[model samples]
Target: MHKILVTGGAGFIGSNLSEELLRRNYKVRCLDNFATGHFKNIESLLANPNFELIVGDIRNIEDCQKAVDGVDYVLHEAALGSVPRSIKDPIMSNSVNVGGFLNMLVASRDAKVKRFIYAASSSTYGDSKTLPKVEDVIGKPLSPYAITKYVNELYADVFSKTYGLECIGLRYFNVFGRRQDPNGAYAAVIPLFVKQFMNHESPVINGDGEYSRDFTYVDNVIQMNILAMTTSNSDALNTVYNTAYGERTTLNQLVHSLKEILAEFDPEIGNVDIKYGSNRAGDIPHSLASIDKAKNLLGYNPEYSLRKGLEEAIKWYWENI
Candidate 1:
């Protein structure tokens, strides 16, 4: 059995990846500092013998080294993720996203890990008006968070060339699904809207409600990671792939869909109103991904669309929250 180390494995996406890895019978070691991750996310997996939790921060090289020791693969997901938060505090974001990322790369190289796959962000496609963002074309970063993620790609490339470490970066577009926190200040749009609708409060739209995104489901992201880790095609290595559902949903359409889905559980939720606000800084008008590379290279067939994934997410939130 392969022993895989998942950094930030207690976070929403990390926890999901760890759970699926364990389900597939891979020995999973989770390293998290609980900075932004909650124990409850991984609470259910504790009893599984194949699952191990390491309480450590990726910012610390020693912690990173310990996590990568004897691990066949490293899924580096431990980064401070939020464009607005990064804008508020770029130093902390850089420390974890960039500095911590470098630590993981070095540790993985030293450990001689088979492969290192990481959670890159679509935010790396900042300030580009390009529709259906392809892998090679990129624009100047619009936020500190974008800069950090872009830097991750650059660092991975250098590591791959210099130390012969195998690295793959999955640039996740607006990922949403179960266990995604909806209560935080930096809560993503889908969950946040669901939470507000559940509470019968008005969910706010940041712009004129035309901002669109290739909102990917978490399952697709997990599939990408697995493919990246296990692919035998040498040509697929040491590069980034846009992990998304390859469709755009405007904020207006998104809220309408959420209301329609959530209304099934509570008819009252459908009555909830939506408010409009000024556009957020560092936010582009529209964001979409071209998943052709991932589909062709990794055989990535995404299982969920926005409505489908939202249904699953709403079900989980209804049951748990």
Candidate 2:
């Protein structure tokens, strides 16, 4: 069986990825410090014979090396996410997202992992006015969080060119779906909105409700990771691809869709008030991705649209916390 290492394996995306990888017959080792990740996500997986859990910080060099030992591939997803969170504590964001990421990269290279795939964010697009963000051209980093992700890409590129480490970066745009925690102050828009609508409370729109996003689903991210790790093409190596739905939806439309769908569970949900507030500091006005590269290169055909993903997310939020 192929062996794989997943950093941040207890977080939202990492947990889902680990499950999918194990289901596909890969031996999986999950490494997490449980800083932002939760043990509950991997509790059942610990029972599986194919899965091993390493409770250690990515910041520690020895921990990183031990996790990567005997693994064939590395899925690097451990990071302090959220722009506002990074804005509040840039040093914390940098330490994990940038510092820890480097540790994993060096360890993976030493372990001779076939491929190193890490999560990149649309925040790297920063202030670019372009409607659909492209890889070659990018704007300045808006927040400290964006800078760390961009630096990951840079270091990955250098590693590939210098040490022949094979790496692929997936630039995620507004990723939201099941297992996305909603209790934190830096909680994403979708889960936070779902939590509010679940309790018949008013949902707050950060801006005028005109701000938009690609809002890619987690399943699509899973597909991209699997495809990127298993691909045979040489040109596809050492590059970045946008993992998104390739369609944009405004916050107003999103809120209305959530309210309408949640009404199925409670009719009172339809009447939930939506409050408006000032736009966020680092928020981009509009975000849409050009997934053409991913389509042609990685066989990444997104199976879920925003509406489809929202339905699944609403169902999960309704069932889970």
Candidate 3:
């Protein structure tokens, strides 16, 4: 069985990936600083003999090296994630997302890991104005967060060429599901809206709610990472793939869906009012993804759509929150 090191393993996507790897009987090590990640996310996995946790920061090269040692694959998921937060503090975002990413790449290369699969972002597609964004076509970054993520791709490509280190970047769209944090100021829309409706508060819609996104589920992201790490196709290595469901949902549509779903749990949730606000800084109007590259090269087949994913997520939030 392959021993995989998952950076930010206590995070939403990393924890899910770690749990899945453990379920498949693979040895798993998690490296986390707990800046944004919570211990409760990976608490259940601690009891498993194959699961090991390293409480460390990716910004430190030694920590990255320690995590990469003896690991067959390195899944780098650590970063300060949020456009708003990045706008407020670009330096911190760059240090963690870019500097820390470079650290992990160097460590993984030294360790001779078979593959380095890191979480890239759709935000890299920034001002492109293209519908159903393709991997190769991108525009100038609109936010510091986008710039940092784009730098991850550039560095990964260079690492693969200069060091002959195998790397794959999963350019994820808006991913949401179980264990995703909803309390932070930078909480994702789905979880945040769900939380607001649960409290019977008016969920605010930014910019008349016309902005749309290809909201993906975390399970599909895990699938992409697994395929990227394990694929034998040489051409698939050192490339990026869109990790998304290939569908778009406007915020208005999204709010309506959430209300409908949550109403099943509490009938009065349908009556909760929705508020509108000015468009946020560093936010694009719409985002959609073309999953063709992933489908052709990685054999990617996403199992959940926005509605299906939201149903499951809402259930988890209802029971757990």
Candidate 4:
């Protein structure tokens, strides 16, 4: 059986990917520092015989080397996310996102892993007014976080060419699902809105509610990662693919859908009001992904639409939160 190392495997996306990997009977080793990840996210997987947890930070090259040792594949997911947070502290973000990412690439190359898959960001498409963002076209990064993710792609490319390390980057677009923390200052919109609506508080929209996103579900992301890791096609290697549902939902439509979905569990949630505020800095007006590359190359067929994924997410939040 193939053994895979997942960095930041205690975070929301990391934990979910680890769980799915374990379910598929892959030997999984999880490395996390708990900087932004929580143990509770991976608590249930501790008892699994195939699952191992390494308490370490990707910022440390030693930790990265240890995690990649004896691993066939590496999934690098450790990074400080959030544009505002990066804006507030670009140094720390750079240290973890860019510095830590370089560490992983080096470790993975040295370990001679079969493949290295990583979480790229749609924010890399920053400041571009292009609709249905294709892979090759990009604009100047709008924030430090965007710059860091874009740098990851460049570093991975260099590593692939220089060291002959096989690498694939999955550019995630607004991923959300079970275990997404809703209480943090940098909480994503879907979970944050669900938490506020559950508490009967007004959920705020940052703009005039016209900002749209290709809000991908976590399952689709997992599928993309697996495909990236296991694909035998040589042409698909050493590149990036957009991991999205290929559909857009406006903030207004999103709130309305959230209310409609949550109302089923508690009718009172339906009446919760939404408030609008000034647009957030570093945010694009519209964000959508063209998943044709992923579909054609990786056979990526996203299983969840926005509503479908939201339903699953709400169910998990309702029971857990």
Candidate 5:
């Protein structure tokens, strides 16, 4: 069995990926600092013999190096996520997302890992008004968070070209599902809305509630990461793919849907109030993804739609969170 090291494996997407890896009989080592990630995410897997957990900061080269040792592949997911968080503190975002990514790249290169598959973001699409975002085309980044994620692709490309390190980036669009924290200020919109409505609190929709996103489920992300780590095509090795279900959902529509879904849990929650706030700084109007590259190249096929994904996500949030 191949050994894979998953950074930030205690977080939402990372934890799910780690569980899938373990399910497939991979020797897994999970490295995380628990900054935004919670230990509860990985608590169930602690008894697994093939899984190992290392609580450490990715910003530390020693931790990165130690985590990569003898690992056949690296799924780099550690980062300071959220555009609003970045705007509030660009330095922290840059240091962790960008600086920490470079540290992992150098460490993985030196460790001679099979491939480096890092988490890129849809935020990198920024101000590009394109209906469905393509991998080859993108506009200037809108937030410090987007800039950091963009820089990740740049660094991975440079590493592959300069040092012969194979890297593939997956630009995930609005991923939300199990293990996603809904309490924090930097929480993703879907989970935040679900939690607020469950608690009878009015969820705030930034902008006019018209800002849309290609809301992807986390399982599709897990599939793409597996494919990326295993594929050997030279053409596909260095390029990035849009890891999404190729659909868009507006915040207004999203809130209404969440309320409707949560109604099954408590009918009273069906009438959850919504408050519209002024447009946030460093915000984009629309985000839609073109998953064609991922489809043609990686054999990637997303199996969940927004409603389907939110159904499971809402159930998990109501039960665990």
Candidate 6:
């Protein structure tokens, strides 16, 4: 039995991963400060005896060491995510994403954890005008958040080489699903759009709506994480893989799909208006991933396309909110 330590386990992506691990009967320990995570996400998991919650912040070295003490694998997902937020407060984002991440790495290494898998970000692709972003080719980081994520990959590589720590970084694209918060100013586009549509409020598109993204579903991300943690291939151990669905959808297409799906539950949603604003700073014009490396190395097979993922996500939102 593997004892896995999931940092930020109360947050959207972390909570989803933790739930799936528990379903598979793994002993899971969740370390969260709840800075952005909601208690409602993990409230049910607390009842399970296999679940252990450590109310701690990863920024503190002692807290990180405590969390990794007896863990077999460390899933480092604790970070302040959002380009705008990082732009607003680079110091704070650095403290959490970079400073805290370093603490976790040191702690995991010291604890002799078998494998360390951490969340990387697509923002690392930055100003590169590439059609399908690859793992090796990258551009200059555009924002503080992108810089921090790029730093994470660099640190992971150095740790693997210098300390012999087995590490894998999963460079996630725009991931969305249940438990993703839709209220905050920094909320993701998909869930945020769904929430606005549910309320019959107009969703604000940042540009002319042609800007595209490889909006990945969270389940696909979970599959990538699991594969990264358990793979027997030595070549796959100390590298980063792009965790995405390998397709692109424009913001206009995304909005249309959301309205169509939500309209099934409430017809009036289709009538809701969409408003366009100036292109946001630090936002790329488009993003797409080349998943060939993940497929060849980790045997990655994505189960949901954007349409299928949007349907399930809309259903969950309708039922929960």
For every candidate in turn, the CA RMSD to the true structure comes to 0.6, 0.8, 0.6, 0.6, 0.9, 0.6
* lDDT tens readout by residue for model 4, 250-292: 9999999999999999999988889999999999789999999
Candidate 1, residue 199: the lDDT equals: 95
Supply candidate 3's per-residue lDDT for 268.
100
**Clashing residue pairs for model 3:** none
Q: What lDDT tens digits, residue by residue, belong to model 3 across residues 25-46? A: 9999999999999999999999
Once model 6 is optimally superposed onto the true structure by TM-score, how far is the C-alpha of residue 63 displaced, in angstroms?
0.3
Question: Which runs of model 3 end up more than 4 angstroms from their true locations?
Answer: none
Error of 1 at 213 (Å): 0.4
Q: Give the Å error, residue 290, model 4.
A: 0.4
lDDT per residue for candidate 6 within 66-111, as digits (tens), equals 9999899999888999999999999999999999999999999999
Angstrom error at residue 143, model 1: 0.2
Q: Which residue pairs show collisions in model 1?
A: none
Cα lDDT tens digits for candidate 5, 25-84 = 999999999998889889988999999999899899999999999999999999989889
Question: What TM-score does candidate 2 reach?
Answer: 0.99
How far in Å is the alpha carbon of 232 misplaced in model 1? 0.3
User: In model 1, which runs have C-alpha deviations exceeding 4 angstroms?
Assistant: none
The residue-level lDDT of candidate 3 at 296 comes to: 95
Better of 1 and 2 by TM-score: 1
Model 4 per-residue lDDT at 189: 94
| Lowest lDDT 10-residue stretch of candidate 4 | 105-114
Give the higher-lDDT candidate: 3 or 5.
3
lDDT accuracy of residue 239 in candidate 4: 96
Per-model TM-score, in order, reads: 0.99, 0.99, 0.99, 0.99, 0.98, 0.99
1-321 in candidate 2: lDDT tens per residue?
A: 889899999999999999999899899999999988898889889889999999999899999999999999999889999999999999999999989999998998888889999999999999898988887778988988999999999999999999999999999999999899988788898999899888888988887999999999999999999999999989899999999989989999989888888999899989889999999888888899999999999889999998898899889988888
